[model samples]
Target: MTEPNLPSGNDTDTNSSAIPGTAAAWERATLERLAMATLIEQRQARRWRNGIRIAWLVFVAAVAWFGWERGAAPADVSKPHTAVIEIKGEIAAGGDASAEQVVSSMRSAFEDSGTQAVVLLINSPGGSPVQAGIINDEIHRLKAKYHKPVYAVVEEMCASAAYYIASGADKIFVDKASIVGSIGVLMDGFGFTGLMDKLGVERRLMTAGENKGFLDPFSPQTEKQRAYAQTMLDQIHQQFIGVVKAGRGNRLKETPETFSGLFWTGQQAVEMGLVDQLGNLDYVAREVVKAEELVDYTRRDNVAERLVKRFGASIGEGSVHALKLAPSLR
Candidate 1:
């Protein structure tokens, strides 16, 4: 019959090739779609990351602005009030109770006509003598300039440098149980030479001057160095004694153990003239100052400043201060 209309070999081969070609084209299209999807997802993720970063920056900026405005707001000076300046914690440079902060607050209080009197709200274990001296000097200067009396209201403990600052006040009020008076200078450190010898650990320290490394804790301390340090302590102690004597005048009851780095309870302090009386902030403001309304003028670190210090701005400086084996008023 004409072998019928049987398919030729060429037709069969063409049809099979067409089927394979179609599969290959399908795979390419599928791969292209997958790639496009991946690109879109990556783009979305990048946008989200950017958005989060921006939000964080905005939040930080808002906090900074609010802190600034709060600090910059002017104090209400319409009525008579007792202007209070806080001296809490360690008194050191770049600290909350630093000379800069205390002095600035003092100046503000003294300059304000509405301020009936200035009160130093002190509660510290003491710190740098230099900072304390600055605040003390400013207390005298501000009192002389404005003819305003400055009183000290002690809470908890006020010793060493805190006592030094309080010495400049007209009167010091304290709680009956408050610990007061460690009126001395000390340079405390541990000599690791013996420990290192036991452990066979050698310390290699380089310095340009012999005295530069004298305070090095890992090295040995010589007799001469010890004497030198003691002499320094004596000199600083004399200065502290002089300040206390001048400030306390006839009010202070002199005793052998008064400046011997000894501490006493607030009751004992009052008996010894180290404290004026047993009282509190409210008592001082109402009775002593004759102004019941109290106004705080303490200059503390704002949020932006604290953030800067918290980040990395003053971290190295703080570490250096911590690592120092130098003299202190405590």
Candidate 2:
């Protein structure tokens, strides 16, 4: 007997394809998924691009703002005012109290027709003597040229090189408790020879000249080198003494301890004729300058200056340290 006629493979396929809507629905779902995935990836990429663009714009705006602020003068000089310049921090070569910044501020103040006098608002422990010397010389020159009195107003502590600059002022005003002097120069460094011995490390230093590595802390200092250093310090000390004498004139009460690199209270400074008076900035502006209006002409580092300095420091980090022969007043 013949078995009942079952559906052939071709007949089954035809039956499945007869449902056209089911096949079309499956294809539509796959296409929709692919489209959604593509849209998501595009959105993420766009967000990243926008974020970078916004960051770039912000950076450019900040740079421009800093540039404008640094280049712009303090204020308009249409009326009489007291021009104030601040000397606050270590007086180093590229510091806030650098000679370049101080001199530029002084020039601006002296050149202004509406400025009655220039005031140096000082709050520092002091730094490089060379920087201080430049500022001191410029102060004298500006005073001579403009015939305007320059006063020094000490805030907290004005010692060493700070005092050196203050001495150039026509009058020095200080608070009663202010630290006022440290009239000396010194070169300080750490001797790592003992540490190196303990660590069993040898220093490999090569120099063309015999004295090139004279003050290297890793090496033993010779007697001749010590004497040479002392001689140099003595010369600088004599130069410092001369400048103090010239600046203070008869106002200074000459004594052995005056230039002994000792700091004193403001009251003692006044008694020793180191400080002219016990007063503040307001007192000087209102009473001394006779113009209550105050204008700050201090040259300070703006954003651009700070960025440049940081960049330079980063680039020079791998360089060898130079021997500092110039005396520091810290």
Clashes of each: 0, 0
My TM-score estimates for the predictions, one after another, are 0.79, 0.77
The reply for model 1, stretches above 4 Å from the true place, is 1-56, 70-75, 314-330
Candidate 2: what lDDT? 0.89
Task: Please write out the lDDT profile of model 1 over residues 1-330, one tens digit for every residue.
Answer: 566888999999998899899999999999999999999999999999999899769758966675654252156776899999899999999888999989988988888889999999999999999999999999999899999999999999999999999999999999999999999999998888999999999999767668788888999989999999999999999999999999999999999999999999999999999989999999999998899988888887776766656655555878778867654422
User: Which candidate gets the maximum TM-score versus the true structure?
Assistant: 1
Reference-based TM-score, model 2: 0.77
lDDT (Cα atoms) of all candidates against the true structure: 0.90, 0.89
Maximum-lDDT candidate: 1
Write the residue-wise lDDT of candidate 2 on 60-164 in tens digits. Answer: 777776773654355579699999999999999978899999999999889999999999999999999899999999999999999999999999999999988
